[model samples]
Target: MGLPDYIPVKGSITFLGKDITRWSITDRAKAGLTLAWQLPARYEGISIRDYLRTGTKGCSERDLEESMDFIQMNTTFLDRAIDKSLSGGERKRIELASIYLMKPRLAILDEPDSGVDLLALREVLGLLRLLADQGSGVMVITHREDVAAGCDRSYLMCDGRIVLEGSAGAVKRYFMSQCRPCDGCEVGEVMRRG
Candidate 1:
């Protein structure tokens, strides 16, 4: 919870077998822990290609093109600035492509499925599966059952606490049966009732 603020927290956060509870955001990133924001930030002057190449060393042109293809993005996006000109879904896909290039040891994606179309969602799901199979630990924060279903494990959080966690199928079932539309029901209330 205090990750961005770098506040001293009570819990332990270990990454790649090292303690990172008190690590700064930059340190955490350098340690191969990446958080893809739900709303990705805009970098006015940076081209999408330059942005994707940030943490990716020794990446070839083919590798970059392949990453974009994996996310179903066109090569034309490479020269465009990572700014407000891009749609939310475009930014999300670009962010995902960057993560794919980085191949971090742990990837914490916040609502990656939000604003994405069904086709793109499937591609994202496939990429996520591939990332997991390639040995990166992916923790996707989402309420979507489809996204959860693709995950190996799922954790349901309510009122800032994880109330249920298990195999994706089990957690998805509990979420679908117990929680109403997020707009129609408060998570705390659902937690209390369940």
Candidate 2:
């Protein structure tokens, strides 16, 4: 689980039950699984409409046009130039919306709340929990304590291996205690901020 056993120098990965060890990034994306980058990836000459069309098969317009509360409302400003215009949080949210469009069985999000605000962070966490509850397996990799707290279960990866795992609360407690002399510094901040 340590970054999903990546071999960066080789640019290969295997996810879930799929041996994507040889699949291209796009191929992996089309296989009922999706990955959101640690930093949101943006398209240069694309509008949100154009981008969504590519991923969603031109269905976003039909669906969003008919309903108002979906991606449209959530991605209020994404319809503009998607190149270098979006804030990190906005781009991340748009990335999440794009992943939602795929209706994937497994979603791998890398630090989805990297630069998001409190409200947006909560929204993302709530949506992730909902996805997991709805029978989608969500694997979120983050160093943020708040993000870990939102997950149903938690695991700690150190030195390229999973060293600790358990309920989220238990993991948090253990992580907090191991930080030494400043038990309050790690978990206390998480509790206080939450």
Candidate 3:
């Protein structure tokens, strides 16, 4: 999640009240900063359990079982390799499961609602809520109207900048009136109004 290019270009990233703008991705992860990517990378031969034990602290089988249950995955997932065989939704849930095991202080999710069905979308939202309830800060990068509306606050980014920030309803209304009519917008770009 801490890829070099992903570093902020303007403002700094403060986590747990500490400035982490200069920290390496590895350093950030060690400090309880975790992310679940939308298009999770495939690990051709890594079993789920082995991959998690390497990435998460205290990731014993028991922890995996508990985390898997949170994501609605059965224990059988532990034995499967995180390869192309698993669907995108499965991979996204598994990544979230790994993040849950980390008990991260802040969780950054990138369009987690993308490429998933409605039922899975609910699981993703529930996981975000659970992380927030656990005292972890949750930052979601999403375009889904419902997902953004479920947040306490929301930001609307345009051209790599935050064009609007407020309650989700306000941002959605503004986007509809201001951005939705732009000729450059992809037909699929509008937030799916809930």
Q: In the order shown, what is each candidate's alpha-carbon RMSD?
A: 5.4, 6.0, 4.4
Evaluation by TM-score, superior candidate among 1 and 2 = 1
Model 2 lDDT-worst window of ten: 185-194
Clashing pairs in 2: none
Per-model TM-score on C-alpha atoms: 0.77, 0.73, 0.82
- C-alpha RMSD in Å of predicted model 2 compared with the true structure: 6.0
Clashes of 1: 0
Best by TM-score: 3
Weakest ten-residue segment in model 3 by summed lDDT: 185-194
Ranking by lDDT: 3, 1, 2
Candidate 2 per-residue lDDT, tens place, 1-194, comes to 22344446654466766578878768877777777777776587787766666676657565543322333344444467787756675676667666666677788777777788887788778767665665667788776777877776677554344557676677767767774442222112211101
What's the lDDT for residue 28 in model 2? 75
* Worst 10-residue lDDT window, candidate 1: 185-194
Q: Write the per-residue lDDT of candidate 1 for residues 42-103, one digit (tens) a residue.
A: 67788988988886889889889988897788888888887776776677778888888887
